[model samples]
Target: MGATKIDRARVADTALRLLNEVGLEGLTLRAIARELDVKAPALYWHFKDKQALLDEMATEMLRRMAAETAGPAPEDWRRGLADAMSALRSHLLRYRDGAKVYSGTHYTDTSYAEPMERHLRMLVDGGFTPGTAARAWFTAYSYTIGYVIEEQAMGPDPSALPSGAEAAANPPADPAPYDLGARATRLAGHPLAVAAGEELFTRHDPGFRAGLAAVVEGIAATLHPDGAKRGESGP
Candidate 1:
């Protein structure tokens, strides 16, 4: 492929596909160029550096996420917030190290702006101040991204074990099963740590939902104390 034939979309698409094969650390510009069958210099025409390509990849991920998450906006702000965060988590999990690709990267397009505006407006309509609404979104976004990053690092399993590329990169010093009893025995020196291991390591799906609910509830109580009364006035 020549420089003229290669566009940002193709480069980003190729990068996303390579993510599953190489993981983020192994995903280099030269590697992407190899997949594209072009010289590494050819990619520079579309993206100046690896971060530039990552930003485009993240932007493309969000674009597909938005396209797939179609529905009537929930009338309740809490539901809207939770739904948005859940959707983001599911989207990030679709690719390997997806949250890593997305985190701290600049967007290549304004496509995210409109949906963000709507979410913030949803919070504001539910009686949160504009600043509070923005903060709430950031809080939830940060939590979801951080959670998925850790989750992916441990692979798709609920155990402390790493799988796939993660395992290949950093094998565990002492590999263990997904057994809570064994995990507790290993952490016996720290009683609290032992006690928490079960909840921390297993049942990730329920744990994530519970934590997200707490975050949403905390935002309501702390940022919008009069939210109930004010929300009653909303359509």
Candidate 2:
């Protein structure tokens, strides 16, 4: 039998696995090539460089997400949008430093054409104006990407807080890492937030959700003049 010609996706999958074990810093073209049992030059023939390969991997992961979540209904746009963001967050968090691969990268690539078409069509059918639809899509994209970037960089959720009594009972005399969370808790001052202090810092998804909802709602408001009047739609 002749020597096997490896698929480009096989290379990418192996690279992602290496990312989980050794992380972004240790990832390299040569390493992936080695893992795939191909020559480094062969890998370069498929992807021009490190960033190019990473961008391809990110795009591929997103394509997988779109395949799983690309369904539409005018009445269901809000949940559809939320589900898309949630899926994207989960995929990026699946590998070590996955967000690093996606941050500041292009997802508007031709390989993403199908999902792009689906997303835009859903927005249009949801009664969004052209500008409003574009803004909503971009806003959700930015918020999700940014949240994941910070999520990986910070190595934990930023929203976590301590119990109120626990916070008050053992106030640190000196500056402490937990001090920031405590201070945020005091500053937030919402009744529900105070009651859920320990649960607050668990994840960044809620903040991201709130932000996307606001953007989607704002866009919907402008697109459907009666949206603020009716309150049953989103971009």
Candidate 3:
């Protein structure tokens, strides 16, 4: 027989399931304990409070994300970095509100270090300065989080423009007043975006990949100083 487990990992897994089912707003120690068929105080033996549980879940998710992107590649640091962000975007979409879980969270934890270190080293090998590499990481990382949040906010639907057809059919007739900020750059002179603009308004992998590529390319332009010559060239 397999040895019985003692650590709180199982409780964390169960709670994450609850999070997926109900969402962050509904996750609680008492609810998770009920899901696991254990009393609430039993959970206390493992986690001190809700924040502790959220931390554990966040760590687990990051570990999985890191594992998905680690590997050898001869192409260049940019492809590797892009692949890493793609994996993150894909995995987060698997769960409701996953982007929110990862945004601005602590990444200095030793567990999250290996993947980050690898990416930074790869960037350096590709001729990026340390400060540039760090900044690129930040830019790409924030883009992933921000993009995924917008992806989640857009429910799955035809109106969520994956092809520009929707936007063409439903262009806001007038320059409408958007709330304080707009998620997409007002689609005005962008062609690939115009030709395939629907992706911008939808929850999709292609759109996510395109946006991440744009952020990474933006970082490349910042680092190399000449990459900017081709600004707004489809990332």
Which candidate tops TM-score?
1
Best candidate (score: lDDT): 1
TM-score of 3: 0.72
If ranked by lDDT, best first, what sequence of candidates would result?
1, 2, 3
TM-score of each: 0.83, 0.69, 0.72
Off by over 4 Å in 3: 1-6, 73-75, 107-109, 156-199, 225-235
Clash pairs detected, candidate 1? none
lDDT of 1 by residue, 47-131 (tens): 8888888999999998998888765567699999999999999788768899999999999999898788888888888878899
Candidate models: Cα lDDT each: 0.84, 0.70, 0.69
**Which of candidates 1 and 2 reaches a greater TM-score?**
1
Give RMSD to native, each candidate: 6.7, 9.1, 9.2
Give the lowest summed-lDDT range of ten residues in model 2: 171-180
Error of 1 at 144 (Å): 0.7
Q: Model 1 segments beyond 4 Å from truth?
A: 1-4, 157-182, 227-235
Per-residue lDDT of 171-203 in model 2, one digit per residue for the tens? 423212244466566868676755554343444
